[model samples]
Target: MNRLMEFIATGFYSGKLPKMPGTWGSILAAILLYFLWPTNLKFQLLIIFITFILSVISADYVAKELGNKDPDCVVIDEILGMEIALLGLSADIKTVFLGLILFRVIDIMKPPPIGFFEKLPGGLGITVDDAVAGVITNVILRLIGGLL
Candidate 1:
């Protein structure tokens, strides 16, 4: 059970990477997820939903164990959020680049309701805020893709 908890907490070992592990894990996961799956809207949305649900549930315990408010090692939320932002978008270099920038901006900025979710207790607070940011980024990406 202990090992199981750690595995989930660290995003199946991606969180354990040395130096900026969470960010690296997220980027790796996003890249793999983008390539491994069919580039379909429904598939991308499904991935986003699953990642969000799993991240929300697991993030709290991970944060508690790490003794930090959203520790850098607990970046499953970022991975899930980044995937969400890229959902249904073109997989071209330009599109992916924009998605990355947009997601990072929203995640970092945490404007309005996204910031509001950050105040919640435990892991819910930690993960949900990023989830909201991802959603916001997703909306913007969809809009930009439509315009282009």
Candidate 2:
């Protein structure tokens, strides 16, 4: 059970990658989203909700085990964030590519409310900032989509 949670928190070991594990997790999310993410908004919301629940559970477990808050290796947050970022957008290459980039940039920057959410404590803190970044990215993507 611990191992299972660890595996999930680690983004199936993608988070173990030496470089930019969150980025890797986001990329993995993109790949999974291509196949598994539903086009229907309702289904998308359901998936996001479920993923968020799993992310919080697994991330909290791993963080406690490792004695670290917001450990880099627990990147289920990135997966959740990526899902939110791409929500409702057309799954076309251009939209997805833009979403990936936008989410990554916003996540890295951690500006404003996104940064604010990082102070929440426990897994919620670890994850919500990225979720906020995802919301920001989604908005940006929507604006871009409208433009082009």
Candidate 3:
């Protein structure tokens, strides 16, 4: 069970990378978002819903197991964050790649409410900040796309 939690939490072990595991996890999440992306928007929403639920549970357990409030290697948060970032966007190179960069930037920056959410309890703290970052990135993308 621990092994499975570890696997899921690590974003398929991308989190185990020697450096910048969060970055690696986000990269993996972007690639995953590309492949898992579907034409039906409902399926995309479902994917985010399911991944978010799983991320919360697994993140909590992994934190408990690893004895860290927010273990760097547990990047289910990144997976869900990236998923949220590209929610309504297409899987094209521009959308996926740009979303990756944007999400990473917002996630790393953690401005205002993003940092506030990061201070929440346990796994909620770990995931909420990234999720908000994704949402912000999505809004920015939509706004930019609208102006174009």
Candidate 4:
């Protein structure tokens, strides 16, 4: 149903919050990650894969319903991206919060290929950029963590 898809796409309506819905979704994701993050890397990857599929489907449906490309009310991408950003990291408050900030920045800035991925059609476009941002953020975090 549209309602179900909308709910998922909107990151359980965090995307409907005033201003920076993407950020809200990411915040929710970070909180979830902090509390529920799995210790196993395989489990983490499985969760990301499942979320990615759901995000793509739900985001595409919502985009078609709203007749807009990457509408503000669709932020499952942010959830997916946040997961990717924090992937494999120890789920501590500091790391989770840092990952959230890095992901939001990279996502907002849309640097390099991130922007390019956003140009894709449908849900793929909606989610790929955030995924890319997450990858970039994850790498940055790893490098930073390595330095410390």
Candidate 5:
């Protein structure tokens, strides 16, 4: 169980890399989005919700084991963030790239409401900020989609 949690938290050991584990996790998420993407928004939301629950559980355990608040290696947050960011967006290269960039930027910037989520306890703190970033990205994409 611990090993499984570690596997999940680490983004399949992409987090074990020496630097920028979150980025690696996001990359993994992109790959996953490419392959396992759902046919509709309802299924997408269900997938994200399940991932959210599992990520929180795994992230909390992994963070505790690592003795850190939001340890860099526990990048389940990044996966959730990317999933949310790309929600309803097409799986084309352009959409994926834009979503990835938007998500990473918003996540890094951590502005306002997004930043606020970081203060929550345990895995919520570790994950919600990123999810908020993804939401912001979704809004941005919606605006772009509307403009086009």
Candidate 6:
């Protein structure tokens, strides 16, 4: 059970990548999630809500076991966050690419409440910060979508 927990906590082997595995896994997850986008806003919201909840719990446990705060290997949070960022956007490749870039930038920069949220303890901190970053990315995407 311990081994199983570690494996799941480590993102089912995605975390074992030699370099930037989490980022790569997140990119892949976002790409996959883009294909799963529902036309209905309510459904999208439900997916995002459930994913966020699971990510917070799982990421926290992973970080604790890995002895780090928001370890790079624990990227389920990023996957969930990026999925949230892409919500309600057009399914075009261009929109997805733009959202991906925007999400990565906002996540890396950790602006405002994102930065504030990073100070939180445990997995809540790990996941919340990325969630805030995702919200920022979503806002930017929405603004751009409005303009174009």
**Overall lDDT per candidate, in order of appearance:** 0.74, 0.89, 0.87, 0.93, 0.87, 0.76
lDDT of 3 by residue, 4-92 (tens): 88898899999999899999999998887788788688998998888887788888898998889999998889988888888878888
Deviation from native of the Cα of residue 29 in model 6, angstroms: 2.2
Clashing pairs in 4: none
**In order, what is each prediction's RMSD in angstroms?**
2.4, 1.1, 1.1, 0.8, 1.2, 2.0
Q: Report the lDDT of model 6 for residue 126.
A: 76
Q: Which 10 successive residues of model 3 have the least lDDT summed?
A: 32-41
Top candidate, metric lDDT: 4
Q: Candidate 4, overall lDDT?
A: 0.93
lDDT of 3: 0.87
**Poorest lDDT segment (10 consecutive residues) of candidate 2:** 89-98
| Whole-model alpha-carbon lDDT for candidate 5 | 0.87
Q: Could you tell me every candidate's TM-score relative to the true structure?
A: 0.80, 0.96, 0.95, 0.98, 0.95, 0.88
Model 2 lDDT, residue 84, Cα: 93
Q: List the residue pairs that clash in candidate 1.
A: 60-123
Superior candidate under lDDT, 4 versus 6: 4
Candidate 4 least-lDDT 10 residues: 61-70
Residue-level lDDT of model 4, residues 1-148, one tens digit each, is 4789999999999999999899999999999999999989999999999999999999999888888887998999999999999889898998999999999998988899898999889999999999999999999999999999
Report the CA-based lDDT of candidate 6 relative to the real structure.
0.76
lDDT of 5 at 17: 87
User: Candidate 1's residue-wise lDDT over 6-70, tens digit each?
Assistant: 66657777887898665665676567655664587887777777777677667777777768887
**Candidate 6 per-residue C-alpha lDDT over 11-60 given as tens digits, one digit per residue, 9 for 90 to 100:** 56676688977667567666776687777889888977886777777777
Steric clashes per prediction: 1, 0, 0, 0, 0, 1
Model 3 residue runs over 4 Å out of place are none
